[model samples]
Target: MSDTQPPRVDAEASTTADSANAPRPPRLGGLPLVGSTLSIARDPFGFLETARETGDVVAYDAYGTESALVFDPEVVESVLVSRADAFRKGEFETDFGELIAPSGVAFTEGERWRRQRQLLQSSFTPARIRSYAEVMVDEAATLVDGWDDGETISLREELSRYSLRVLARSLFDLPLEDDRTATVIRAANAVNRYASPRRLAIGGLLPSWFPDRVEREYEDAMADLETLVADLVAQRRAADATGDDLLSLLARAEYPDGSRLAPEAVRDQLITFLFAGHETTATTLTVACWLLGGDDAVRAELERELAAVCGDRDPTVGKLGDLAYTEAVVREALRLYPPATGVYREPTSDVVLGGYRVPAGTTLQLSVYGIQRDERWWNEPATFRPERWLASGTGTEDGGWTLEDDSDRPEYAYFPFGGGPRHCLGMRFAMTELQLALATIVRRVEFDPVADALEPSLGVTIDPGPAAVRVRPRREK
Candidate 1:
């Protein structure tokens, strides 16, 4: 279970390993070395379809390593939550640990991850996130102010800018005054494109001695990100201030041993927050806008809720709870296109999942994408229905919403922000950011899709495809 020990099976050995001795799972039959990689590369949904055809528990080879693609929610739960200690973040994440930065929650494991999580948990508490709402609302207003009525724009691009501004102000205590915001936005997109699965799979196959282009791109992006974070940290350190900002909290944070985080640790966490916090929230907001535009009923419902709660004033943390339909739209969007897409784990010991005995060291992929839409749990799996979330009486009785019942749903089926002790540290911050951005956008403008059909494309996060929307300012009544 030690982090330093490599898995027993080498990448090449996994390619030729016999399933007869090892537990055999259903598998797609096509090519020898590259099984379903083309289908997965072309369309991730299609790859899931192939996985379904094979069965809930299907086997596949990626980068010369055999992996089990577990689509069953219960089985996914076993790996992610119920028996989480039996699993570790798979080799794919480990290979890019340095690329993710050196010391934040994502790159660390075991005691290090636990210690960091403990120290950072207070920063993302619901109350703390609520305090950050004004920052989000202010930034959102700025974003909407720049848009003209009846003008066509990419929702994805706009939300990216908006979320980056929110993250910059809330997390780093830095205003999105000029080129800094643009640089962060560019770096995030560059990192996303470079970390696409197609590139990662190819890079995973290459030897450690080789320089991966994608890796280099990721490093360059991280370097820019580090410079921004380091400058911020140094400034805060010189001022000796403990301001009500995430960076200040981090800068002043002390370990149980009374030691401050090293500069590299600060840089790593800043990068983690930037990548994990903004990008996913931005994507969710963009998809929410697209869904609202495409469906008249949903848009009307959202507008009604927003008008009722917000009235003529901008949304504050107190007002956010009143936007029920807005929250519903966000929930449905996440269910349909979870930003994390999938949770990955590797078994520490032989374990039986979905009636198959997977050996120790087997890499496992828990498909949040597949399980969220699985017919077994949802009535109309493919439809955009926020009512389903309401039926369980878990979200909110009044206009105000809470996540009480979200956990009551089948475990891994609802991981927009992952699960277990290793769940995203900034979940509350991201949610607050999304809620404010979404409510402000709805209040200022009506949106309509420019494309006939909008599709979710798989990237580092699930992204909307080839879709621009026309935005119009709401008429004064």
Candidate 2:
């Protein structure tokens, strides 16, 4: 099974041990009150690098909380998988989840999160994701048809629209207009800014009710999101027959006692899916295209596979299994630039990690970006080589490549969608979307990077800043 596949989170064994004499992790020193907030705000990658120098488990005060930046893959697995019940979503996640999607599955803990996940799992089953394939390709084709040959465009901008369109039609069964897409883009940016280190640092000094400009914009954006969610819920409810879309499935979903989700609860799910469903996929595609643009051999290999499997026709659900190279490109891109950046958790009780005793309520930062690119787990870790995802084999019966058996790698070493039971609910849906959309677009056009370098900055997601590309029709069949 793919390591990304959900493992039994109910394993009786816990990784934590009672080591009362275990020393506290080495600390990453910073300012008295705000701690490393400014350092992180200025350069998150640099801050993470500094943490690496300190040790595998480096403790520091973040916004006055006892926090540690963990680099060891084993410790990461302990926190995310083996000893998952021993931790909860940290204060950062709880605060941001409330700002973005209160009462949604992303923030709720214990029984509430479990119940919500069970109710929603039906919509993301393998069969259900397969049902979304047609919509994914149709949106990709529409996006390609609109692009003029040799036109320079922002990949993030164009792909974000395509992703949102696919998300709307497939999940909500709603068609998007230019205006609605624009609204979502703006609102997503506003919400993302709230999690920035600078914002959080300043927020600590200000009272919650303070009427600051950033605060005002955030509230307005949230209001707009709430309005959008309300409208979608209303539309789905008024329909004559319930549809197979996520919103429709959620509308009729019931708990063990037969109680349906309240209106606000349903709204929260819509908003949560809206943000998670579209944004992460767009970031993945944007980076994939950017990486593909700079590499000739990889692009040629991708095109060869595309020709072998898809011919002149656009990608479809039936062809995805044969598009191994295309899937690898997406995987490699995610490995380089995971959308979540890192996972945050807090010890529910004092626990031992990396032979250190962590106090209860101490925040743990598991850097997905750091682990995926570590030299120990990945050879030539920084290179964009999709071939790494292929196993040592010749051509398939249909002349396609075979994907790698990643069981050799550590489980926590490559978790762009995260791991354990809290693994992204949309993991399958997002992969299917990226593969179908990528193959469809590549079959139609080729991209050249308009800018030589990608200035990656920290945000709610890794913003692929200034990723402009020139698009033209592919010359070869």
Candidate 3:
């Protein structure tokens, strides 16, 4: 499976075909004027689950615009992979593009996106990622050491700061100054709060001139973010862009035509990484800890695996392959609580999805959240079972557990970082970071969840709202 191409599905014809005569999808009943806007904002998980029950492809009105929520893996493949060019970013992307990374790889299309991806790909390669393992382990250790035994802490806040620290050191070659750390945290939270489904819907309905509190905070955050980025860029430039960090690489990299990213373009890419890189990984770590806290058996097995592979020493890049159980834990957590809840696309023209004709410009919300948890694909959809991702070793020298070949399920069924050419550039970086961080932290401290239940909020990423855990130091054997 090439990184640029998405996995092909068996039902390619029906998914990619433009069937003009195909009937419109079954409508998901909603309110008269506001349609499903209020319902979706109030309970996106429930609303999407209801949409799933309606059909593989269900239609509904959001405000005045008609939208489709796609559940079938084949249809998702068509939109994200096979006939991807037939679709563009959904309506929300317009908001993101203007406010976030307008010229960055995330929002750019066609040639510009490709060029930026090419330049950025070098920093995320497996070899390059491995080089950052020590930093990841060291940071995780620092984070764990900060917790007093029996102290309760908010996993989201602690992990978010840890992720930001790692990103700054590993990629930017900039140490997060103590005074600026709070600014980064506030800015990140402001952007995420503004991106909530409810706020987005309200912002869309209201006029641009409307003085909304959320948008106001977001704009102020962006201003602070701009200042932060300018300082970092200036620091890097003064050092002559000679470091091995991502910022240095982008500064010194050039296109085939001998052109380099302008200063503003570099800033855009920096912001893209800051917003996209830190939050998603932080949420994932938080959820992984939450899941581990509730499942003693699974957590014990994970700790055992860490002890066997990593021993008394910290996790290293070379031992990552042997930490199969640790990796599976991460995989299971992602399946249950994917940070990227859904992907949105709009058709460039009329297209058939599961035999339903969707009109041009109709927003298609690929339900990653619903599909990953669908009972049809998973045996026990709501359960946290890391064993599902492991297989008895076939060819390893030690015959230890290895990652299961995912032939039993659809390729898109467990895409935590999305798929196709637009798949996350930092997939390897993120996995390496999570696996190392989880192993490093778990080996030293045991977590007992303080929160009763995870109330997943639909934010920029799926937020495990207000979840806390009590940390107890593990007595050395």
Candidate 4:
């Protein structure tokens, strides 16, 4: 499963006796029984930032679960990379049976995850993504075409819909009609809400077999989504479909021993891509726009680059290589509010992290949010400076963006996309789309934030909430 999958939180986990004598990480105090639930939910970004200062690896009790939150790059690397085999993704993997699709890559482990990753990896290659770029530009342009100058719009909501449509056209090779869009939205909304930390806290306390209200809602939404995906697959097969989109690629793929993905397997992957593919990019884009909207100098530089490189035309694939500044803006936005706030991993056996023992059943959360913002890895950590991504050696020379220079930095310090084998499959696709869409929209509209500061809605993704903006088309030269 992609790291973008809502972390499957295990509130019931406890460390073993083997780790009893290990140096304890500082704990953030919280209310009785409920622990730090309310505080974390109220301001996750703020909480993590403050918590990281307590120590790189700090313990926190949220919703009755004792978790060690890792913020240091070396420690984050240990969990996500070096000792990866010693840990498995927590509750979401062993639990959440049919709650999510039945056994997709995001939740699978060991050899199962390997097989699925290998099979799916072929469809997202650089060449395949290049072939898919036109669909991205067209979908983005279509969304921009619908906006009005000087009109206030929720960039989050609009881009959420746009990214969903882009996923359909670019990878799925389908354009969502109104009804289809509604179904997907319903499924996505329910899944995100039901999987939220608040919901997980409550749901984890109850017996697994108990039919809860949110579980019923999730099942209903999944039912609609599964039916839609199944029908699409069946329709393709009945017509002897021939195409190069991801759906068709998966439809025609085989197992090493001359077997095809099970009917349910196809459904699982389709649901994963459709549900996960759009939300992260949309969140990143909304946050990026808001950041740029509030900064004239950054926006002007971005505008200047767009004008110089794209020049009176929509951005084509070849021109994107010159859009270094625009790409940096997206990267900086991601650093501030990564699509996945934290990743959850549980050690199967006792492991040493930051000189502390994480015994079996103890859950470890790598706080991507805290690490990205922590000054240990950044210069002026809290600043929204896209120039952090630029260096002297690489430049367009015509005053466009210089190449990003972070050769001195550690990779784990700013991994908006989680690292190691389970890194996001859609990383390149999402990056390409973000740059094109941002360029397409900013080439015309300039955003002015409606409020002094936007607040984050830490749902399935850390969305920029309901922040609206007034967009006016830039005057023609």
Candidate 5:
């Protein structure tokens, strides 16, 4: 009934036209309600199959609304970067607005997001992130010490806990031994559970509605998170500390006009960093280890590079870039299994994309997962290959892979951390953390896959399921 709604077509006329001229899109192959959901649950890669059948762009009607799905890199770039203002964070993000009400940079828009971004920029600068490398290496050492030789363990969980500790220490300057660590972890897990597909779908359908159980759980988790963050702020306030830790920096950060962040704002920023910073890095590290476990030659090459550069000294801020192989492995892992499976944006105005008229107000789903593995850009797209990144001639002369030749490619072809002015602020810090963790693990131990294949579970982030890998301390030559 709204003026912005797409023109409705009579069913009979639409069907007649479809039957006469157009190819029908891929339909749900299984039982009605279970079809697409079941496919997505079973294999994350099947979405691409559906896309192939449906053309580069498809529309899905879910939860009483229509949304467009785009897989072409150019279309993706158009939606994410080229005409970004026309779009805001779409359903996927808005669904959790209530849960992350005071969301710092993650959920804000326009002036608020811009101002907050400015305030936090210096905190994640290359110099600052480099300064934190020792902290990451030290934490990694503790994790290595904790592992028992020849043990088959779930590396995902171990890395998750380890990254959580490092983020707490390096970013907030909080001691890992702080009692609040457990509470923060619990709250993070609760948020993850509440952000599951079922919950997200429901939230998308009814933004203002909150189920009683979910509401209660979210409130409880928020309370715990609030207490932890409030305590940290109070501790910083009392000490008047001006240190390199993210918390200290935030505590001291002032606007251009000379106003400090309010307590609520600070709390939201902390929550954003706490969740966003650790989860993705942990997942990347876990997947990287799994990938390395399967490839003996790559693993040995990584070890050789690390030994040549580090020489028994822990990786320091100055030496992180020296671990080129380690950096490539991390980049390849991200390309293969990005932490955020998709990015969503809403068009501000009517625009033409990929020769199709995309009207304003449509929610666009940019499948980063699909774009990364698109065969056009990558040779042997499904296989794990780090060498492509190391080879100079692999990409085009313009500094992208062959898949990026079309004007549409660069804007959309590769967006692991996103692109444009709104690109991820913590990218530098994340790269440092990942490099340190990978170097430390590969240097101290060797891992072997326990199974023939590791299944990926699509969650808030892409997760490798129940990865049990055999580990042994490296035998010195």
Candidate 6:
């Protein structure tokens, strides 16, 4: 295969509609109009699994809306990278625009997105990330200190607090009070709980003006979130202080024309980071710890790497390269349960996908969850196996610490951090934080989870459902 040739996988889609002008992908769902929206919104992961069984590319009626779900890697490439110019952030993201605003980088596109990305790029560079590692390590160690040996802890809540604290410290340069941090965590979880796809779909069936408790709760959380940041920004402005945190970075940031982000825009960006960076990384850490808790061999191997690389000291960027197996374990956990369930984008103009001609403006849902779990792409797709990443040997040269490139695996198959130009900008920092936290925590404590099936509790990000771990110190301090 030529390097430029977009590598094709054994993925195919069933056509839903046949037309000389636009051939549709296969359809998956129930009766017309409402379609599969209810089923999908009720259990998103299960819905996607069923959709994939129907075809690699399948069309479904989501409430009054219609969308094509892309499970094939080639189609994902076309949508995210190849034909990226022809597509921009679409309906699904726009649905949450009120939460982050169009000015926020996550929801913006075109020139605005470019400028926003450029303005924010410096905050996530190698040097910038290295600077943030100390905050991450300190937060991880602090979390460790709180855990007593043989104490049963709720992984999700504790990790949520830890991740929020890290973001609060590293990005904002302010410490979150215990009460305030608890409020933040509670509000975030409330938003996720009520913002399910089913709720949105059901709500859509009603008038636009109809009251939505979950939506209201999510808004309340967002309001609390905005107030929290606004207060911090106000304090920073009053104090005339700008430290090394991302808040400091943005407050002091200037465009080429020497203009600064407006106050509201600054708040939007802060909330974006809080939403995008905090909960997702928290989910990653929580799930990683849970996954390791179940597998003794994996934990032993990771502990060995931690002892060899970090010894009794906290982990930092300088020691990341030595935490190969630890990082691989993170990647594998993400593959098994990606935080972001699906990716959505729309075509700017007409494009053909999966041998079916698709008209412009058709909303497409690229199932990241389904793609990563497809048996065709992974061996024992359902099992938690971190070693597959090591065997790939694609990124071990960096000691498996860097994000694994698409050299060994299909590019779109495992895009937990996303791909193309719009891929996550915080990838490096998130990876760093996860590796450091995993190393720091595992080095000091081992987790023994209570026996349970542990179904994924779906929310803004997937969480390990209701599983508590017994934290036991592995070695003397």
Clashing residue pairs found in predicted model 1: none
Summarize candidate 2's per-residue lDDT along 1-477 as a digit string, tens digits: 112222222223323455365567788789888888788877888988878766777889888888888877778888888778888997868878888887888888988888899888878889988888999998899899999989999999999999999998887778988888887887887877776777877777888778788778888988887887777666767784267667776666556478777766777887888898888999999999888889988888888888788877888888888888898899999999998888889988777777677788888888888888888789999999888888767444454798985787877888888788798999999999999988888878889998878878876578887599999998774
Question: Per-residue CA lDDT of candidate 4, range 124-184, in tens?
Answer: 8999888888888888788877888778998888898889998888787888886887788
TM-score of decoy 6:
0.89
Q: How far in Å is the alpha carbon of 220 misplaced in model 5? A: 3.0
Off by over 4 Å in 4: 1-21, 31-33, 92-98, 202-216, 392-397
Q: On TM-score, who's better, 1 or 3?
A: 3
Clashing pairs in 2: none
Question: TM-scores of all models?
Answer: 0.87, 0.93, 0.93, 0.89, 0.83, 0.89
Worst 10 residues of 2 by lDDT: 1-10
Clashes of each: 0, 0, 0, 2, 2, 4
State each model's C-alpha RMSD to the native: 6.4, 4.7, 4.5, 5.8, 7.1, 4.8
lDDT of 3 by residue, 1-477 (tens): 112222332334644354555677888778888888888888887887788887788899975688988888878887889878778886656556777878888888878888999888878878888888888999999999899989999999899999989998898877897667667778878877887778867876898787789978988988998898888787777889887678887666555467978777788898899878898888889989889889887887887777777777998999989888888889888888888888888987777777777888897878888898998789899999988888754323332567884697888777788778898899999999999999998888888888689888875479877678898987554
Deviation from truth (RMSD, Å), model 1: 6.4
Better of 1 and 6 by lDDT: 6
lDDT of 1 at 322: 64
The residue-by-residue lDDT of candidate 6 on 1-477, one tens digit each, is 112222232222212232244545667757666788788777777777777877777777775676888888878887788767778887767766664554688987778778888888867889878888988888888888988888898888888889988888776778989977876776667666666676767777878787777777877876786777777777777766656567776666556578777766677787788778888888788889998888887887777666666666777789877677887899988888788877888876656676665566777878888889888888899898777766453433223333344465677888888789999999998999999888888877888887565668654467666568899888532
Clashing pairs in 5: 74-408, 86-348
Q: After superposition, how far is residue 153 of candidate 6 from its true place, in Å?
A: 1.3
Which model, 3 or 5, shows the larger lDDT?
3
User: What C-alpha lDDT does candidate 3 achieve relative to the native structure?
Assistant: 0.81
CA lDDT, every model vs. true structure? 0.73, 0.82, 0.81, 0.78, 0.71, 0.75
Runs off by more than 4 Å, candidate 5:
1-44, 201-219, 252-256, 392-411
Clashing pairs in 6: 14-26, 16-25, 16-26, 41-198
Write candidate 5's Cα lDDT for 337-446 as tens digits.
99887777776655555544555566666788877887877789888877766644542222222211334335466688987677888888898899888988888888
